[model samples]
Target: MTRIGIVSRQQESDLARIPHVVRLVEDAGGTVVAESELRTADVVLVLGGDGTILRAAEGVRGTDIPVIGVNFGHVGFLAEADPESLADVVARLVVRDFTVETRMTLAVRVTQPDGSVETGWALNELALEKVERARMVDLTIGVDDHPISSYSCDALVVSTPTGSTAYAFSAGGPVVWPNVEAILIVPIAAHALFARPLVVGPDSTITVVMNEMGFVDGELWCDGRRRLAAPVGSHIEITHAEEPVHLARLWTSPFSGRLVAKFKLPVRSWRHQERP
Candidate 1:
């Protein structure tokens, strides 16, 4: 018998469907387990929006356990199935008819002025934003130990290819395909003329140095889940993580199709184009 781990959104609406989903897993010859036991299970089924899926991913990071998400939130970009199709989803899991996609993640290391270092990881993007909304933060950027640029901005987002569609997209960063191996850096409301988004190779090490002349403090956010204080004279280093998150995909639809469906982009003209 296959052992499955189950996790759900904390909202009342999402919690109401957990009992039904648990029953479906049991009927399919799979034993349901708690989220804490995810490493021991064959697969993890996440019920909720992308936030819920992120939480589940953190738990199974660095492990081969694949995760499948059911959309229960407003934007289900990461979710592979819907709540209405519980029966079909369970059937596919039982038959092992699915593909796993490995997504790159970012590893962050923050060195404080006192010589203490803090580390964290993010599947989406790591952001450095000003703590005071009224004041902009001064940042000096570097790549592979070489100076890149220095400027003042509201925030900076260092994202992986898998994170291009998240906070990076909203910050005017290019949308990189998931299969691409790249890193994106976008400046939010920058005050300099040379402020522009940059895409770097996967092997590069990106660093952000906070200027000590700035009066206000800054904060570092990892995938919007974990946060740390980034004081003046602090150094933030970001690099590619060795272990990537594995997502179990049931459908073989191309990424372009998924993009159109999620964003509802206008494709009427393309649909009517002449075929070769």
Candidate 2:
């Protein structure tokens, strides 16, 4: 019997549906196990939406256990299967029938004046943002320990290609395909002349220095879950992590297809317009 682990949104949005999911797995000849015993689990089923998937990403971060998402939220971009396909998904999960796609992750380190180092990791992004509204935080951006520029901005989002579709995209960053290995830095509402989003090589390291003289201190959030404080003169370092998040892909469709379907993008070409 395959040992299966299940993770759900903390909001417990679909509490009523969990038992049904369990029954499906049970009927499919799989045993539901606790995430604490993740080492023994063959694969993990993540329930809920993209946010829930992000929350579950941390649990198996440095492990080989792959995650398969079931769409139970508004936008289920990260999910491989929908509620209507639950029975089929459960049957597949029983036999571990899926391909694992490796997605790059990021590791963040926060250095305080007291010489204390705090670390976090995320599958989406490492965001350094002002704690208060209507206030911009001052930050000095750099690559490989070399300073690039200083600016007062609402936030600085450092994301992997896999994250380009999440917060980074909403903040005016380009949507990079998940298979692309790169880093994107988008300065949110920046007050600088050259505030365009930057794409960096996968091996490059990024540093963000927060200005203590600014009106508000900043907070560092890893995938919107783990958090660390960034006070004045705090230095934050970001780099591609050794560990990658594995996603169990049921369909071999191109990522572009998922993008168009999820966003309901208009595909009508102007060249195909009927001439009057």
Specify the highest-lDDT model's number: 1
lDDT of 2 at 35: 60
- Model 2, span 1-276: residue lDDT tens: 988888876665576677888899999999987667765788888888988888677777788988889988877888998888888988898998889999999989999878999998888898898889888899889998799999999899999998898899999999999989999999999999999999999999999988777778889999888889987789899999989999988889999889999889998754755789
The per-model lDDT (C-alpha) reads: 0.90, 0.88
Candidate 2 scores a C-alpha RMSD against the true structure in Å of: 3.2
Candidate 2, 89: how far from true, in Å?
0.7
Q: Candidate 2 — what's its lDDT?
A: 0.88
Which residue pairs in candidate 2 have backbone atoms (N, alpha carbon, C) closer than 3 angstroms, thus clashing?
A: 212-232
Provide the TM-score for each candidate, comma-separated: 0.96, 0.94
Model 1 ranges off by over 4 Å: 271-276
Off by over 4 Å in 2: 11-13, 270-276
- TM-score of model 1 (CA atoms): 0.96
Error of 2 at 2 (Å): 0.9
Model 2 per-residue lDDT at 22: 89
- Candidate 1 per-residue lDDT over residues 1-276, each given as its tens digit: 787788899989877888888899888878888887888988899998888999999999989999999888877888998878878988788767789999999999999888889999998899999999999999999999999999989999999987898999999999898999999999999988898999999999999999897777789999999998898899999999999999999998988888888888887645556789
C-alpha RMSD of each candidate structure in angstroms: 1.4, 3.2
